[model samples]
Target: VGNDTEPYKTQKYYGQSAFPSSAQTLTVLYNDHFKPEITTSFETGFEIRMFKNRLTADATVYESVTKNQIIDIPMDFSTGYSGAVLNGGKVRNRGIELTLGGKIIDGDNFKWNATTNWSRNWNKVMELPEGIDGQQIIGTGGTASIIAKVGGTTSAIYGFGFVRSPEGQIVYDNAGLPAYPEEIQYIGDASPKWKAGLTNSFSIGNFTMNVTIDGQYGGIIYSQTHHKLSEQGKLNSNNMGRETGFIIGEGVVQNADGSYSPNTKQVKTADWYTRYYRRANIESNSFDASFGKLREISLQYNLPKRWLKNTGLQSLQFSIFGRDLATVSDFPIYDPETAALNGDTILPGIEMGQMPSPATYGFNLSLTL
Candidate 1:
């Protein structure tokens, strides 16, 4: 079928227009002039097995291109409308995945098997509509915003950052406190560069055990909870220099002649923490998303054949399972996996007021006749 413009014209009856003319004064805010976006993708991979199927490996590489991306653009007051959307952007995404498995120990009485999988991804914006630099903020969650900028990573975390001089030395204001960037800058990449998971299984006669460990690396997450708590003087980092005389910042100051010298100024303990925690920048509030977790474990046993022979049941098994037993991460409070706003919104890495994932432990029983 041919492409159609104004695809939603027939759906306009559901909004303000549905009411009688006397019921309201203000009506629809803007016209819908957007079209459906298109995405093209390609994927290719290979798998190999050896040692009588005891060892196996596979890898995949994929690329996807999104064209005519639709985004809600802000409008000026003179237009008498809040916003208008157009489709005129492009982005490219590519990634690779790898999987490996092997039966390390094979025997009649005892057997052990292990498997691991890994993945990596990269993405960037290629184009945008004319007259637009292709910079758009999709959402503001917590202290950072999810932004898309041409030639930058997709849905990068954008927010204020500490001002740094050309020599990468921290810049300070007249108050002897750190200064913030004049505009929002790329604070961190929300997406992970690499991730991996490993699983191990053991079997001895009718008894079995399984364990899984998983990790994510090379990413950043903004923690709104930590920032707010620190501001309230509840965090340990904020309390460290409380009884001390003052806190000395670590950086060199740039002189008028472009020479750098160590900063000798000291800021009040409370004032320093407050300023940095409250208005410093996303980098201060950001934490590494890299973490490893004991993802899952289980133990199971089947009844002896002789014991079940007299019973009507053909087989019986019992098992105990646990998930998310422990995690090793520098990020405090809620899990980094928690998304303040999820579903359809591509911006990630900003967490605010979200609950932590609960650990689960349970028993399972099965019977067959």
Candidate 2:
């Protein structure tokens, strides 16, 4: 919870002419009657060791409740204010985490230790402010947003999507273009279903090496960067049709008598891609946020005490390390671990103008007296 006033931020995008007033625009509104948001949490955990303390396990379960959540109040664009900040309502989250470790090999000159951790979390909007109709927009990028809906997860993407039939088939119109839902709806959850990590350490002859890997299993993100890139034919995915100059849309088109027919109309490639990958086409622009990465690796050599005895140093060690060295993800423009920035607020799930994932490598030395 915070009682201090928040800072105002606006990123003026001059070159983009897609949206109405893309040059410099107003995004958020200030409110006078602001209340601090508060969250209360409870947790229970345990630690256990077995087999002469060579094997260990730790587990915890937690529940949290948040009230007066500071969120955005939806406003009409005609009013000149895209959204206003206010104290929304209640939310709940529950999760559990477990970690296990064991010594795979134990010896005087050689040893191996491994550990793994896994966690799962679920959240729900318990209540909403009056007149919100059970859902409230919390963050926005382009035309899509992160929203909190009653009985839904707090991190949900709200946007327009391609209209589909009962069997999960894309619906196309007479123009051979995909149709869309007139009403905005919840498209996907931004929160990951589960996350896991693994670490291993090896020691031999006064030398030690450690490796760590981590991953997020489930989630989705709406990326405006991907949309813009695809529309501009900068992506390999949208470049194929350019050579042929045109492409036919794949779906069933509605006929005059209301029957559906296979769409064979060859729409211009440029027009097809631009409309398909536009920012407002949230569902088409969103993708799975799942990713796996080699989080870190390090190697260290510790000088033997017998050799250090003659030197002034009591202990000495040298280490080489690398972090975020590698990653495997389906995200197009940057890392899947991206979020939307609206003013001073950081909202997860939507991506726009975020930086790429970074990697670091370095060497270090330690001396003990």
Candidate 3:
């Protein structure tokens, strides 16, 4: 069920009109409203085909729940007013999907084919409205801001880190670093827990080949392209270097019979006017949960039906392709799939030279008449 209504008008005058009959103004203000929403979903799946059928498989699982949720909420303009749409809230999403097909060989002059797919997603915000416990929903790519929040959990990573301590802990800054708190650091969970794809094909007699691969797992990427390439140093000009020294482990700060100190005035610094910029480079460079091969291998040819059998042109084909190409990851810098969940700030994932992810060797042609 769903419904909605919106209308607005305004005009007010109390000063300056020098006489239109001593000027005094007021115009009709109209506002009408209605909102309705309700949704529920559940899905199940199955599929299988074997051997003779050339083998095929499929699987699925899904869940969705949404209610009310018409958010616009956020207004206190010092009492100025202009912000309203409310409807409490609720959101939930659960998932699983898998697919596979095969035909390793069909033989008739030689043939082979393959396919694969995978997906998994989970999102939740359950409810919100009432003093707003923590609200934010993904942002970062250069200033749409946000960066995570909203019932959080999934290993959160919203942006601008280190500033905890309301019992949350993580505040430090006498010089030992880590102590940002002007605001920012939505913290954790950049999405992606699983996603995958694979493809393969081959042909003989006319010659053809194709291969593909893709992956994304566990999620969490806030490298802001190595924090804007380590703040302009250009991150060693893409060599991406950073390990500047001074993060002496865990909340750091010892000696009182705890040992570990190399005189920097007996050490204990960390607080350069709120622990260095961009919240300590987003809590010390974040990266993990990877598995990218993204794109790969392709080759093709097909043109020989007795050279298209007298121009009737039955078939013809050609191919070549490449992209982003390769990545395994220990992540020293660059490649984290160039990170972007979508918060569009001129294409986020700011790493400076900022335009990697290109490796195309393109060529394609197809004709059949």
Candidate 4:
């Protein structure tokens, strides 16, 4: 594969850096010392067929190591700059993919075929070239943020989390709301544990039918839209605790001596949700993205030869197809496959006011000469 690298980045200047007059002056935004990134990868795949070549299987395993990772490293403004683009990290990824296909039945007038595929990936940060702390900010869009750390997975969702007692009981603050740690905490991972798909096709006489179902399991996504709309009292979740006078959060409080006691704070109805449910910057906004979808379906039929004998048309076929017809997911907003930003981005699994995936259906006609 070809090398992937970003263009060289330079510090911003308030004025032109070059001299255009007798005197020239400018302010640099940050120090610019970035190097190109490099990735080394190796992959191997094999295929097998059995049962009189009616069943076939293929598998592949691959690993990749990326070095000299160019990232925008953060810095204190006291240094006269916000951050700098520098070559400062390493990441490794490994995965396996498997596919199986079978001709379940074959005859002069009837045929059926099936295919399935599955894949899984694991990633880790091998090193940080800048020698910075274990965790560093990599990307941010609205309340959602991504952080990279040594020995941690990539694209990890970083946000505020509720404090808990030693026995895993929620801790409430004096204000009766769930207390949050001062520092941002890693709350969720954006990578799925595995993905799979199945497709089947059948044909008899002049009619054919095909359908596919796919699914992704074991990942989380943050919905900035849900957070915002809930805060605005527009989401159904916002209705909770509103009709009631108060709602008590579940958990125990930790006293000064580190003793855990049952929480007796009666958080006001509005106060309870606004602090815990709203985007008060405390609640974990991440939700499971595991979902299954009816990806595609189609039906086709070939016209009988006698139907167009005088027209000199040897063959004609008509088909009706649909895409993204249905989906089942726990995610509250749009389809789990939707992304806030397209193309290559530092952070994934973030949805900020994303549109729903539209289902499409159409018909096609083909004529053979």
Candidate 5:
């Protein structure tokens, strides 16, 4: 509410082992005018069951607007401080969610149930604090960054891209390399367009089974992993023209008369791969981050009451399950669902050498007396 200060001390040693202590201050300054963030929201939903509890549905639509967002804004060097924490901006979010559940089979000793959930959200930056205009940097990931721009999604990514001709064709340089703008441009949004999940459960006699699947549709990610692998020739596509010693670039080139022509320059095999997949070339590494995953599958068995009566026990259950078993997507790398990690923060739409998602398998046993 007030300020942040670190009681830091340093020691200065003299020639003859005499030491003096000096106090140090941090680079961040706390603003006295900062206030707590406030959010005003409205939500409406309905839950109903039809056909005598055999089918159920839940629907919700909500809108929320947040004001006075707490943020750190960079300060001028003359201030002797790096940044200041202030109440900065406003953001709006609108979304809808739907969930449906059904009891497909209802019989003695045998039963089955299925459920599905779907949700979609739209996020926009309504306004920025006074003095800041156009856009503000929210997070950074290597050569790319997350930005909150007015009228745009909150998780918009800004990065460099290839310079193209009027016809929207990539314009290559005489060296057969792609050309980029002098400044960063809007790439894409990291927020997924929609998400959905399905779950199925079945029980027959003393045995039960469950299966779950989930997926995210739409959104893009700048993958440093893909570029690093391609640059090092670790990817299979990098093998092109390796034996032939040279690779031909594919793009249009500006001619002498201000017109365009097909590029025919042949670059060295090593040079083509290195420059084409360079870390700063965001266009080549960015990919659609949509994917469907086999989230989980499990089977369980319970001891029958007739058998448990002799053991002086009330109930017992044993189950085995597997999680993150598989994925379906056009993503070139290990997992499409990834985010850039900075200290304790995780920023989406940019991947920097993310570890593969784990596949877990285990069993469980339960008992009661």
Candidate 6:
């Protein structure tokens, strides 16, 4: 369990002293408030051994919940303030982990061993006080966007879906395409269902080797950067550019004679630009919600014991590893592991030439007295 508190105070006033016969202070205000939160978590697991202790395994599952989450909600400055912090919502998470180790073969001259670990997590929004529903809980890292709701899971992205008519029917354009408005729709979320990992090691006749792999599956990532770049004509490779038609279609606000009409037409590229990009900051598009294998593969080897012994060294080893080694998507950009879902940072999963995570190849030595 955990708890937190914040305090704030405010004062607002208008003043005029001596300003070249002009007025100065329109509005002066100082404000502050206090907010507190608490969190609790629990986990349970087990360990077991078999085959005369040659094989060992362990598994664990955990659940965590937090309440009174404080956030700096943006304010309408027209009301005379920039923003304020409030205790608004709650979140919950649950996961399971499994690890195994086994001596495939053991003997004085040769031995073989293997080890693996796997895990899966589920997150949801447990509650939201009044006036705040269907919000998105974006992360601080890459471009991941999670959704928020009462009883909804964590790392979910919640926003407006395509607009529907008053009768709850999808509006279609003359082109027969579903007209998506430049405005966002609270249609779906971007959260993974699970993640997993594995590792193995072996030794035989004075030589040893090890390998490791890890991955995450069943999640979604929103690439705001890609959206912006694509709109600016930067990401020519992004085929989504061909999608200039609006889901809400188009409509004339006023007739040439100053009258309005319900006959809206298909939105054009100009409308798409003004509505989706210029105004909304280009974050509404570029969402990849697919299951994928994040990364896998690693290898290492130890120097022969006899060679190390003769060199007066206790041990010596070398290794090489690669990340984002493979992907199952047709995404033309780089790896999709660039996004995160938590706070209002930028979008994640948009792979710019930002420094790619390094894959290391090196060696090490250890000596014991």
Best-fitting candidate, measured by lDDT?
5
lDDT, candidate 6, equals 0.55
Specify the highest-TM-score model's number. 5
Q: Which stretches of candidate 3 lie over 4 Å from their true place?
A: 1-44, 50-52, 55-57, 62-93, 102-105, 125-150, 159-181, 201-212, 217-220, 224-229, 232-325, 328-369
Error of 2 at 83 (Å): 7.1
lDDT of 4 at 143: 69
lDDT of 1 by residue, 1-369 (tens): 113344333234333456576333322243355566778899999999999999999999999888877666776768665555567788898999999999999999999999999999889888876546557777887668887788887668988888787778787765767776688788888888799999999999999999999999978988878877886778766766677858777766667887767777798877777777764368789988888999999999999978987799889999999999999888887577757664556357888766878999999999999
Which residue pairs overlap in candidate 4's backbone?
A: none
TM-score of each predicted structure versus truth: 0.87, 0.86, 0.35, 0.86, 0.92, 0.65
Clashes of each: 0, 0, 21, 0, 0, 47
lDDT of each: 0.79, 0.83, 0.59, 0.79, 0.85, 0.55
TM-score of 3: 0.35
**Runs of candidate 4 exceeding 4 Å displacement:** 1-35, 78-80, 232-240, 280-283, 304-315, 342-346, 367-369
lDDT tens digits, residue span 235-337, model 2 = 8777667888887877777678866777788888888887777779899999999999999999999988999876889999999999999889987877898
Per-residue alpha-carbon lDDT of model 4 for 1-369, expressed as tens digits? Answer: 334344334544454445575443332234365455788999999999999889999999999999887666666878765666667678999999999999999898999999999999999999986657777776776666777888888778877777878787778887778887777777788889999999999999999999999999988888877776765567776676677778777887778888988888887776676677556352456789899999999999999999988897899999999999999998888798866663466357888778878999999999998
Q: How many angstroms is residue 32 displaced in model 4 relative to the true structure, after the best TM-score fit?
A: 8.3
lDDT of 6 by residue, 1-369 (tens): 656543222334355668666655433233344345677899999999998999999999999888877665545689775655566677888899888888887988777777777787777776775455456344433322344556665544544344345545444444434444666444344445566566666666545665555656655555555555655646655334256544343342334664444535555544454444332231345445443543534455666677766677777766565555556554434555665333435444433343444444445444553
Per-residue alpha-carbon lDDT of candidate 3 for residues 201-258, written as tens digits (9 for 90 to 100): 8888778777887877765555655654444445443221234323332353334674
Task: Name model 2 segments beyond 4 Å from true.
Answer: 1-36, 71-88
Candidate 6, residue 134: lDDT: 54
Error of 1 at 12 (Å): 4.5
State how far residue 133 of model 4 sits from its true place (Å). Answer: 3.3
Whole-model lDDT for model 2 versus the true structure?
0.83
List where candidate 1 sits over 4 angstroms from the true fold: 1-34, 252-261, 309-314, 342-346
